[model samples]
Target: MDKQTILDVLNNLEVVDQQGGDEAWMLVDVTPEMIEELDHVGVEKETVLKYGDDESVCILALAFGEKYANFWHKGQLVNWPQEAVDLIEEMESALRS
Candidate 1:
């Protein structure tokens, strides 16, 4: 995926939930389709796939104001592709405006 494609995905992200209270966090599930797109852009496929066999394997939780992006897999924090992370952070920043 090129930069625009990645950005598009981020823009159209399917928000799963928003934590309540002072620190409202945005959550988006990381689907297999996302992985496929990222794979085209050099994201590691095998690593994400090995975690599960479903359409989605992880959740991308972002604290937009805090500039934090975390990948949650099976309730644990997991390292995601840096390119994807950078794209997500950019998207979050844009959303804040």
Candidate 2:
């Protein structure tokens, strides 16, 4: 996916529980290399929900247990590296999920 496509996905994502007092947030940049990692961990785009941002890059809002993580990437989701995908999956499973 290109930068615009990734931004669209992130912008359109739905937040399950934004009220969670202690939630972690992460903004991840997806790339082609990351696809393998996502596939390995079985993470789908539906699992993610995006929010508003004030930057040129894609913004990923992840909230978990009083911790909010934001990831800013200049590249597109389709070009994300495997390491990036793995990190996202790990965070979702261990923290968010």
Candidate 3:
């Protein structure tokens, strides 16, 4: 999938919950199907799994207001996974540019 196509999928994501302290920030439960789509778009399973627990994980996107995206395991961010950071940096640089 192309970048726009990937974004189209994100655009269609249903809001699962609001993030704490930021009323405009919301969580989207990234389903297995969604992960497949992301994988098709070049986000590897390893990258996705970096944020996952034994059960599942979230692909944290800004529900509304500001447009942002991040991955989180539980409510805290994990730094041990280099692939996750690389991906995040790529996306962040894209946004910055």
Pairwise TM-score winner, candidates 1 and 3? 3
| TM-score-sorted candidate list, best first | 3, 1, 2
Backbone clashes in model 1:
0
Give me the candidate number with maximum TM-score.
Answer: 3
Per-residue accuracy of model 3 over 13-86 as CA lDDT, tens digit each: 56566556443344556578867876786666676555554345444432111123334434433333568768
Rank the models by lDDT, top first: 3, 1, 2
RMSD of 1: 10.4
TM-score, every prediction: 0.35, 0.24, 0.41
Clash totals, every prediction: 0, 29, 0
Tens-place lDDT per residue, model 1, 1-97, is 2434443444455656646445544455567677776566554567444433345433232212112224433343334678876887788799999
- The TM-score obtained by model 1 is 0.35
Better of 1 and 2 by lDDT: 1
C-alpha root-mean-square deviation, each candidate: 10.4, 13.6, 11.2
- Between prediction 1 and prediction 2, which has the larger TM-score? 1
**Where's the lowest-lDDT run of ten residues in candidate 2?**
62-71
Q: Assess candidate 1 and give its lDDT.
A: 0.48
